[model samples]
Target: MSRLATSVTAALVVAIVTSWTTVVGDARADTARTQPCTRYTAILAPGTWETHIDADPAVPVGMLRPLGDGLQWQFGRDITVLYAPYAASAFDQGLTYAESLSTLEATLHHMVATLCGSTRVVLAGYSQGADGIGDLATEIGNGAGPISADRVVGVGLLADPHRDPDTTLSLGNPQPGDGIAGARSQDFGALTERVRTLCADGDLYCSLNATASPFLSALGKVLSGDPAPIAYLIPAYTDPGTLIEQAVTVGAGWAATAANLPTILEGLDTLPRLLTSGDIAAAHQIASGLNAALSPMVQAAASVDLTLVASVIRAAAAVDPSGWTSAASVIADALAYVDIQRIAFTAGHIQETLWRTMESLTRNDHLQAAAELAVLTPSVFDLADATLGPLLTAVRGDLALAVDTLLDIGGPESIDELVQLARQGAALASFYGSNAHIDYAEDVQTLLGFLRTQVAS
Candidate 1:
């Protein structure tokens, strides 16, 4: 599915970037306080993504919300979460992936150098931010950073929505892989378990795409939205003390590179109509002719400009004593979902892997990390010895394949005709024996509902 801001304009992007939340008290200042760890939760938003991370500056993100109510409890402790935006690398306005990411790296590097490095951190993100966090986590987990995974104590992630899923009609109707199919709560667990002492879990955003099948994509969690880096909220100045020009440059890049987002959405809208037609074989003809799972979703959830979300928050920040009234309800339920799934994915497997990763955590820096890594960590690493390293090495291929499947199948046209496509998935699974995309059908339905809320809201 095209999980991005379909209509986000460049101008809006320049208006929303913003800050950090650091708690100065000791860890024991208040067992009830989520801020005692000297925290920095920075959000990076997309020009058209959801408003995650710090919904409102004064309010703590996730579990740290000021009101006792907005707090998310896990093992009875509040987790300090940060969201960093990832600008699209292909913005038409003179931006590229290398440059956008470089901007993020510099900011994160600063955060680590100035504050985050001293204590444990719970780096969190969605969409592009998710990708960045994973990349960042790997660097930190593999080498040196302010806080190591072992020291981090926890990592919470939402739908990373980076892969593709099958879009055959057979996988329609929430049978499986509702949103971002291949991305299981368990998958993210493996990625983050090494960081926190506790079990890790993530929110999945899988949705039903056209192609009309009842089975779900094995890889569907692709629509997770974006959050921007905190830096963009307050507008910055160039060397001459003027506004930075590339702020909107990234948006232009997206218009050029991922411009297909609107087309994808429009194409999928036809699936329901196609499935409703009376001819099953004709529908099958349509289904059999296409390979939806091969396409997958695209774009950086970091597509939305954080500046826009910040503008919304700035307007509403002082409206009431509580930030977002509904945040309490949303966070509580979501946390419950994440915590339960974390246990299921780990099933005690994570604890063992954690021990293995640590042995090499401080060692294999030169091989696994960027050239500058050894200088960042305490210097003693070796991933080869870590049991979970093998799984991580394998993750890239699995996820890459998953991405292709989602983009190929989900689109406005594909969505209009899912039932027959879902039936096709059943046929494929029965004959081909359940490929990666087959499992996401059911979950896609769930994702549709969730995604609609995040943006249409």
Candidate 2:
């Protein structure tokens, strides 16, 4: 089935399942509430787009609903399963992932404050929800959270964006790498023993190959409102003066590219007709104009290091609340959806195409020059049209494949090879948005059972 069909079908299934789960969960909550205070309270946070800010606490939904229901069923009066109500939204849905994270933190804090002193806590979250819970778990484990380390019995994270296989105990099939948002810098500290993470083999959210797409991983960190990844991702530019100089260089490059974009695009548009009409003189003139306009941009683009740009973004994210910080965050978030590798590839192709066209013109090879410039025209249009939007809307399948190719081959030898790799990578990246991430409730039954045992013991 097409990816879109699969996604639509999955959405339908989730909607149906969530609706039924709500009814079942409400019933379970009602029964559990009648019992006396339990020895342990299990706090659950659902994934992005799973629950609303004012969602009913008694009705757990999304991927964690089954886990919540199972805990209530197994323990009855021994455990209280509370589904945290937060703005479970993506960046476009009013509240950003960072805002939702704050909401989740506040909910956990309130739960910890009101719980009985003797009651222990178990935390569980899925996807973006897992991202927040993992961060909190790190804080508590490091002796800075709402509850003490000993007060927490078990922590379960499904498809956690901050998953670090090196630090946390992983269950189920082995994954390729740590979470796409990159791993938490600080280990779980005192709570490390109690925390367990589960990521399905193909789920990129929790198992993205950091080496292949360091920029994507870095972007993930920025989106999650974490700046620590920048330090690790770009360790070489620690000196302030050097970092500033690099940033200035990148800025100047982009500025020049932006300045010449209009002229380059115009030339690309007009050169084709000129070539097709046997206007050799006109075509050569246009090609020369394009080369001149594109030269500075191509040079700038070649020297543009995306890694450094990400670091600058990280520095911006770390700043105190201000217009600049907010703007940086917005820009970073928008960039998360952009197919940067594809853009880089296009930029490279434009330079190569322009070079060939110029060479053909010099040799009086009008036909060859026309053919080459034809290829250049579409690419220029595509680059010109590339805009900031959701990844799905902007690059769709290409983004994943481009990332995957970069991961597999280190770099493509030719555009054809890159295209082939992109096809394979799309399938790999599609797993992130697939049912694999959402169906973890069944996949993680073993972990849930372990949590029950841990709390009981």
Candidate 3:
């Protein structure tokens, strides 16, 4: 039967199920996606390759497919991003221990391969998706369960936690195993092999973890009757002619960085929530220690521009409220860490060098040490949950495959492309608005500033 035919049949079935079973909304809506589609899922057609990211519960209640680097209207073989069904059955009696998310991941991977031809799948997970590690659909969100996963080519997790389990790696914390202390990344294959935790200091106030201090700091300056230090810097804006080779190089699809930072900020906020309030002092100490441990990375990539260099620094500086003079400072510091890391990957000469450096952080004994640094000491890995968006996707190397095309479609110089990246980043943000119902318009607003800022020259 044709995919459309199957969709028709499935739609009819879903109609019936919704009428009788009451499995409406997001899960029910995504049922229409089961059609053997060529548009988006076909991108994952067995051999062709695509990313398998889980949509947040708040994502729009329908089949969502991002076209053209998620920047514009375009189509290709679609990759299936399975949604968690909301019917009580999914939790009450549907998903069992053996039916873990790993099983789901296995099934998705297997089906894509078996049906699609050994499709190279990148398992990109988000929020609870990351927290559950390898948990089944139902067990995610608010339970102690593991996601069943194996035999997938690549994996990415967002805003996930990798801190001392002894604190509260319980039902909601993103840590790995139950009844264990160091299992935060035990089941997280992606980070286990390559761990990079870029964090911001003061992310807890909003709970969504999507807050930024740089943007916030900018606002703080505006609020405090201070002028944008941009007066000192804006004059340096290079003319398009002069920046062609360099600005194009620097700004090329750099909008992805806008999308990347928020997720990391939110993920970093997991610590306070993870730490027992009883140990607020201990938790603060831990955050400081984690910051100190990762301080070398910024120094490692000093040759990069100020923006990149500063992002790395802000990762640690954004750890808490009282430590810094203000939120804007924290934003600058945290973003410095994150942007620095990505800039390394963006620089033609250093992309590979940076990726290897990032992956190396997770090798051998350094693996546990790093995860421990984030989890035990300060646990910047937690930033993976919300901000895992681009890094996790980039690390898997599929999105990286689209580098030239993404650059082409988004354009090396087109502000439209830049806007689209931010809009897509905003679209990514809308998921949080939907899931948790927070007025995170600022998430979109935050990206807008960077999107508008010309970092090229």
- Candidate 3 per-residue lDDT over residues 257-326, each given as its tens digit: 4333333244255444544342333444444443333333333334435463233223322332333222
Candidate 3: global Cα-lDDT? Answer: 0.29
lDDT of 2 by residue, 117-191 (tens): 778899988887788789889999999987799999999999998889988997777687888676777999999
Arranged by TM-score with the best first, the candidates are 2, 1, 3
Q: What is the per-residue lDDT of model 1 for residues 295-331, given as tens digits with 9 covering 90 to 100?
A: 2111111333333322322322222122221121121
State the weakest 10-residue window (summed lDDT) of model 3: 42-51
Q: Can you give the lDDT of residue 246 in candidate 2?
A: 39
lDDT of each: 0.30, 0.62, 0.29
Model 2: colliding residue pairs: none
**Against the true structure, candidate 2 has what lDDT?**
0.62
Considering summed lDDT, which 10 consecutive residues are worst modelled in model 1? 238-247
Error of 3 at 101 (Å): 7.9
